[model samples]
Target: AQSVTQLDSHVSVSEGTPVLLRCNYSSSYSPSLFWYVQHPNKGLQLLLKYTSAATLVKGINGFEAEFKKSETSFHLTKPSAHMSDAAEYFCVVSDGSTDKLIFGTGTRLQVFP
Candidate 1:
């Protein structure tokens, strides 16, 4: 079975400051990982993904995550954050063999000026 744990339930950042959301994963097999973001009343959006190709995966809106097998981590990071970046972030894990996905509790980002 594959699972993911979002270390932080909420994260707050000032505009223009860096943002970091921590996540740890456990998988029986090589897992496919993803970071999804959802704004208030908006649908989920794919921020980035890791599919065993590269350790460092880049995605839309200047967000990126690095797969660290040694650390069992896939932490999301951005050099700077914007007000628009505030949202609920989820860390998802898939076994790559099934459609089933395990999602973390999510981390809500609050961006303030």
Candidate 2:
């Protein structure tokens, strides 16, 4: 079985500050990891993915995560937060062979000016 846990349900940041969102996971086999961002009332956009490839993965909008096998953690980070960055984020995991995906509850990012 594979599952993901998002440590925070919400994150608030001021414009131009850094952002961090924590996540943890458990999987029987090697897993595929992903981070997705959803803007207000919009569909999820793929932020990044880890396919047993790179430990340090970079994504769009200056977001990135490191896959830590020891801690089973993959935390998202951004150097600076933008007002437009206010949205919901999800940490996701997929079994190496399945089409189904498991999603974190969600983290709502509030950006203040």
Best by lDDT: 1
Worst 10 residues of 1 by lDDT: 93-102
lDDT per residue for candidate 1 within 1-113, as digits (tens), equals 78899999999999999999999999999999999999999998999999999899999999999999999999999999999999999999998798798999999999999
Candidate that scores best on TM-score: 1
Model 2 Cα lDDT, one tens digit per residue, 28-77: 88988999999978999999999988899999989999999999999999
TM-score of the candidate numbered 1? 0.98
What residue pairs are clashing in model 2?
none
**Residue 21 CA displacement from its true place in model 1, Å:** 0.3
Report lDDT (Cα) of residue 1, candidate 2: 84
lDDT of 1: 0.96
lDDT of 2 at 83: 94
Off by over 4 Å in 2: none
